[model samples]
Target: MLKRRLLTAALLIILIVLEILYLNSTTLAVIFAIVVALSAWEWAGLSGYLARAQRIGYVAIVLFLLILVYSAHSFWPTAITVFLLSAAVLWWLIAAYWVLRYQQQCDLLPNSSPLRAWLGGVVLIPSWLAVYQLHQQYGEYWVLFLFVLIWGADTGAYAAGRLWGRHKLASHVSPGKTWEGFAGALLVGALFAGGAAYFWLDESEALYQIGFVLLSLATVVVSVLGDLLESLFKRKAGVKDSGQILPGHGGMLDRIDSLTSAAPFFLAGLLLMGSLS
Candidate 1:
C-alpha cells in the first residue's frame, strides 16, 4: 500500500506539473472539468444514485455547468464571478456547520438525497472556476501555490498524525485524524506560504508576511473542513473510500477533497486582500 501510494503520488505530481506548466488556461479548464465530472460520478454513488444512468446524468449536469461557467469572461470581483464564488463560500460554511452537527445529520438524513446531488455541484463547479480564474489572473505560479498549500497540509497532517497523534480531531467522521495532525497542517501551511512569500513574492515587507501567514492559516482551516466534510459524507454513506479509481488514492474526489474546499476560500481571500492593498 505504501509503495503504491508513493508511486501514484509521484505520477500525479508529474501530470499536474505538466498540466500547469504546459497547458493554457482553456486547456487546463477542460482537464479540470473532466476531473470534476469524475468526482460528480463518484458523488452520485455516495448520494445513493446506484443506477449508472443516474450517475452519468449527474456527470453531464456538472459538465454543462462547467461549460456555462467557462464561457463567461469575468475577472475577480465581477458581479457574476463574485456571486458564484460567494455561493461556494457560503456552502462551505454550511458544510462546516454540518460537520459540527454530524451525528444529527448522519442519523436523520437518508443515504441518497437530492440535497447531496446538488451539493456535488456546489462542491465542484466553483472550485474548478477558482483554479481556472487563478491560472487566468495570476498564471502558473499561483496555481502551483494553491496545490502546494493543500498538498503540504496533507503531508504535514499525515506525518504529524503518524508520529505523535493523540487527541482525536473528528472521532466520529474520521478516526485516523488528530488535533496534533491538524496543528502540523497549520504549521506546515504557514511555512509553505512564508517560503512562497520570501522566494516568490520577494517582498520583505512586514505586511506581506502577515497577510500571507494569515491567509495560509485560514486556508488550512477550510482545507481541513473539506476533508472532514467528505469523510462525513462517506461515513453517512457507509463507504470506506469515495471510489477505487487510483491504486492507493481511492478516487479523484478523495484526492481533491482538500482542493475542492480550499480553492474558493483561498482565491476569495486573496482577492479581498488584493483589493484592500
Candidate 2:
C-alpha cells in the first residue's frame, strides 16, 4: 500500500510540477478541471448518493457551474472568496444542526439527498475558479504554495496521528483525528509554508518569516476545517473511506479536501498581505 501510494504520488507530483511550472495556464486549467471534476464525483459518493442517476445529476450541476465560473470576470478571487465563505457557512450550519439535533432526537441530515445533487455545484465550481485565480492572479510559486500546504498538512496530520495521537480532536466526526495530530499538522504545514515563502519569494526579512507563520497557521486551521467538514458528511453518510481510488488513501475527495479549504485561506492571506504591504 505504501509503495503504491508513494509511486503514484511521485508520478503525480512530477506531472503537477511540470504543469504549474512549464505548461501554459490554459493547459493547466484543463488539467485542473478534469481532476477537480473527478474529485466532485468522489464527493458525491462521500455524500451518500451512490446511484448512477444521482451521480449524473451532481456531475451535470457541477459542470454547469464550472461553465458559469469560467465565464465570469474576476472569477479567480471573486469565486474563491465566495467559495470559502460558502464552505465556512455550510460547515457552521452543519455543526449547529448536530448540536441542535442532539436534544431533539432527529436526524441531523434527515434529507441530505438533495445535497448530493447540488453540493457539487458548491464544491467544484469554486475549485475551478480557485485554479483559475491562482493561474491568472498569482505566480507559479503562490499556486504551488496553495497546493503544497494542503498536501503537507494532510500528510503531517496522518503521520502525527499515527505516531502520537491520543486526544480526539473531533471524536464524533473523525475519531482518528487528534489534537496531537492537529499540532503536528500545524508544525509541518507552517514549516513547509515558511520554506516556500522564504525560498520561492526573493525576500529575506523577519517580516517574511512572520507572514509565513501567520499564513501557515491560517492555512492549517482552514485545512483542518475542510477535513472535518468532509468527515461530517462521511459520518452522516455512514461510510469508512470516501471511495477506493487510492490504496492507502480513500478517494479523490479525500485527497483534495485540504486543498478545498486552504486555497481560499491562502488566497485571503495573500489579499491581506497585499493590503498591508
Candidate 3:
C-alpha cells in the first residue's frame, strides 16, 4: 500500500509539474474547474446525495457558480478579488472551529441539506478562483511553490507520524494524525519556503524572507485544518474513503483537500504582503 501510494504521488507530482510548466493559465483554469467539479460530485455523495441524478445536479450547480464567478470576476475590481479570497479564509477559520469542536452528536446538518450544498460551494469555488488568479497573475512558479509547500508538508507529516508519532492530534477526526507529524510538517514546510525564497524569489531583504517563511508555515498549518475538515465530514458520513479514484489515494477530493484550503490562504498572504500589487 505504501509503495502504491508513493508511486501514485510521484506520478501526480510529475503531471502537475508538467501542467504548471507547459499549460497556459486559461488551460490551467479549465483543468482546475474539472477537478473542482469532480470534488463537488464526491462531496455530494458525502452529503447524502446518493443518486446519480442528485450528484450530477450538484456538480451542475457548482459548475454554474464557477462560470458565474469567472465571468463576473473579469469585470470586478481587485478589491473584490481580495474580498472573495478573504471570505474563503474566513470560511476555513470557521471550519477549523467545526473540526475542533466536532463530536459524534446527532447530524446537525443532515445529508442532502441545502446547507451542506452551500458548504461545498464555499469549500470549493474560492479555491479554484484563488489558484487561477495566482497562476494567471503571478505565474506558474507561484502555483508550483504553493504545491511544493503543501506536498512537502504532507510528506513530512506522514513520515514523522509513522516514525515518532505518539500523541494524537485529533483522534476523533483522523486517527492517523499526530502532533509530532504536525511539527514535522511545519519544519519541512518552513525549510522549503526559506530555501525557495533565498534561491528563487530574487528577494534580498531579510524581512521579506522571514515573512515568506512565516506565510508558508501558516499555509502548512491551515492545510492540516483542511484535511481535518474533510475528515470530519467523512466521519459524519460514516465512510472510510471519499472515493476510490486513485490507486492508493482515496479520491480527487482526498488528494486536493489540503489545496482547497491552502490556495485561498496563500493568496491572501501574498496580497497582504503586497507581493501582487
Candidate 4:
C-alpha cells in the first residue's frame, strides 16, 4: 500500500509540475476546473448525495458557480477575488472550530442536505480561484513553492509521527495524527521557507524573508486543519476513504484537501504583504 501510494504520488507530482511549467494560464485554469469538478463529485458523496443523478447535479451546480465566479473575477478582478478569498479564510476559521469541537455524538448533516452541498462550494471554489490567481499573477514558481512547502510539511509530519508520536492532536477527528507530527510539519515548513527566502531575497530584505517564513509556517498549520476537516466529514459519513480514484490515495479530494485550504490563505498572505501589486 505504501509503495503504491508513493508511486501514485510521484506520478501526480510530475504531472502537476509539468502542467504548471508548460501549460499556459488559460489551459491550466481549464485543467484545474476539471479537477475541481472531480473533487466536487467525491464531495457530493460525502455530502450524502449518493445517487448518480444527485452527484451529477451537485457537480453541475459547483461548475456553474465556478463559471459564475470566474466571470465575476474577469469583470471585477480585484474586488471579487479579494471577496472570495477572504470568505474562504473565514470559512476555514469556522471549519477549524468544527473540527476541533467534533465529537462522536455530534449531529451530522442529513443525507442530501443542501447545506452540505453549499459547504462543498464554500470549500472548493475559493481554493480553485486562489490557485489560478497565484499561477496567473505570481508565476509557476510561486505555485511550485506552495506545493513543495505543503509536501514537505506532510512528509515531515508522517516521519515524526512514526518516530515520536504519542499524544493525539485530535483523536476524535483523526486518531493517527499527533502533536509531535504537527510540530514536525511546522519546523520543516519553516526551514524550507527560510532557505528559499535566503536564496531568493537579498540581505537587505531580511524582514521580508522573515515575514515570508512566518507566512509559510502559518500556511502549513492551516493545511493540517484542512486535512482534519475532511477527516471529520469522512468519519461522520462512515467511510475510510473518500473514493477509490487513485491506486492508494482515496480520491482527488484526499489528495488535494490540504491544498484546498492552504492555497487561499497563502495567497491572501502574499497579497497582504504587498508581494503582488
Candidate 5:
C-alpha cells in the first residue's frame, strides 16, 4: 500500500511540476478547469449521485460555472473576490465546527440531497479561481508554493502519524488522523515555508519569514479541515474512497482535497498582503 502510494505521489509531483513550470496561464486555466470538473464528478459520487447522468450533469454545471467565472473575471470587482474568498474560509470554519460539534448529527443530511452537489461548486470554484489568479498575478512560483505547503504538511502528517501517532485529532470524521500527526505537519510546514521563503521567494526577509510561518500554519489548519470535510462526506455517503481513478490516491478530489481549502485561504492572505504592501 505504502509503495503504491509513494509511486503515485512521485508521479503526481512530476506532473504538477511540469504543469506549473511549462504551462501558460491560459493553458493552465483550461487544465485546472478540467481538474475541477473531474473533481466535481467524484464529489457527485460522494454526494450520493448513483446515476451516471446525474454525475455527468454535475460536472457540466461545474464546468459552466468555471467558464462563467473565467469570462467575467475582468468584471468581478476586487471587493467581490475578497468577499467570496472570505466566505470560502468561513465555510471551512463551519466545516471544522461540524466536525467537532455535530460529527454524527451532520451526517443526517440526506444522501440524495442537492446540497452536497452544490457543495462541489462551493469547494471547487474558489480553488480554481484562486489558482488561476495566483498564477496570473504572482506567477507559477507562488502557485507552486501553495502546492508545496499542502504536500509537505500532508507528507509530514502521514509519516508522523504512522510512526508516533497516539491521540486522535478527529476520530469521528477520520479515524486515522492524530494530534501527533498534526504537530508533525505543523513542524514540517514551518520548515518548508521558511526554506521556500528564504530560498525561492523573490523577497526573503525576517518579516517575510514570520509571515510565511503564520500563513503556513493557517494553511495546514485549513488543509486538515478540507480533508476532514471530505471524510465526513464519504462517511455520510457510506463509501471508503472517493473514487478509483488513481491507483492509490482514490480520486482527484481525494488528492486535491487539501488544496480545495488551502488555495482560497492562501490566496486571500496573499491578496491581503499585496493590498497592504
Candidate 6:
C-alpha cells in the first residue's frame, strides 16, 4: 500500500507540475472538472442515489462542465464568486436541512441507496466550478498553493499523529486523527504558506503581503476542514474512501478532497484582501 501510494504521489506531482507550466487555464479547468465530476458521481452513490439516478446526476455534471468550459470568456472571478457563494449558501442549507429533518435525515443519508440524483449534483457542481476558476484566474502558484497547503497539512498531521499524538482529536468521527496531528499540520501549513508568500508574491505591496499571510492561514483551515468534511460525509454514508480509483489512495476525491473546500475559500480570501484587482 505504501509503495502504491508513493508511486501515485510521484505521478501526481509530475502531472501537477505539467498542469502548472504547460497547460492553459482552460485545459487545466477541463481536467479538474472531469475529476470533480467523477467524485460527484461517487458522491451520489454515497448519498444513497440509485444507479439510474446517479447516471442522471452524472449527466448534470457533464452539462455543468460544458457550461463552465464554454463560458470561459465571462468575468472569471465574478462567475467563480457567484458559484462559490451559491455553494456556500447550499452548504448552509444542507446543514440546516439536516438539522430540520434530523429524524429523516440522520439515518437516511440518501446513500448510493439514498440517491437524490439532481440534488446531489447540485451540491457538488459549484465547488468544481469554483476550483476550476481559481486555477484560471490566478497564477500557477495560486493553483499549486491550494494543493500543497493540503498536502503539507495532511502530511504533518499524519506524521505528527503517529509520533506525538497523546490525545485523540475526534475519537468518534475519525479515531486515528489526534490533536497533536492537527496542531502539527496547522503549523506546517502556516509556515509553508508564509514562506511562499515571502518568496512569491509582489513584495512591493504591503497589502499583498498581509493578504497573502492571512490567505495562507485561511487555506490551511479550509484544507483541514475539507478532509474532515469528506470524512464526515463518508461516515454518514457508511463507507470508507470515496471510491477506489487509486491503489493506496481511495480515489480522485481522496486526493482532492481538500481542494474541493479550499479552492473556494482561497478565492474568497483573495476577494476580501482585494487581491483580485
Q: Which segments of candidate 3 are over 4 A away from where they belong?
A: 77-79, 103-112, 275-277
- State the C-alpha lDDT per candidate: 0.87, 0.70, 0.88, 0.90, 0.85, 0.68
Per-residue CA lDDT of model 1 for 49-156, tens digit only, reads 889999999899889888777666443337756987899999998888778777343543344478889888999989998999889888988898889889998999
Ordered list by lDDT, greatest first: 4, 3, 1, 5, 2, 6
> How far out, in Å, is residue 95 in model 3?
0.7
Candidate 5 positional error at 51, Å: 0.4
| 1-277 per-residue lDDT for model 6 (tens digits) | 8899999888988888788668877788678667767777676666666477655666576566557644753656576566555676456446434433442335433444334454445445555666666676676667777777878888899999999999976555566878899998888887887787778765548667877877777677656666665666677777888888877888677787667666666766676666464
Listed in order, each prediction's TM-score against the native is 0.95, 0.83, 0.94, 0.95, 0.94, 0.82
For residue 121, give model 1's deviation from the true position in Å.
0.4
RMSD of 2: 3.5
lDDT of 4: 0.90
lDDT of 6 at 204: 45
TM-score of 1: 0.95
Model 4 off-target regions past 4 Å?
Answer: 103-112, 275-277
Model 2: worst 10 consecutive residues (lDDT sum): 99-108
Candidate topping lDDT: 4
* Residue 178 displacement in candidate 2 (angstroms): 1.1
Clashing pairs in 3: none
Model 5 pairs in collision:
none
Question: What is the lDDT for 82 in model 6?
Answer: 64
Residues 4-45 of candidate 3: C-alpha lDDT, one tens digit per residue: 988998999999999988899889989999999999999998
* Model 3 weakest 10-residue run by lDDT: 103-112
Off by over 4 Å in 6: 50-53, 56-62, 65-80, 89-123, 275-277
Give the number of the best model, judged by TM-score. 4
Off by over 4 Å in 1: 74-77, 103-112
Which wins on lDDT, candidate 2 or candidate 6? 2
Q: Determine which window of 10 residues in candidate 1 has minimal summed lDDT.
A: 103-112
lDDT of 5: 0.85
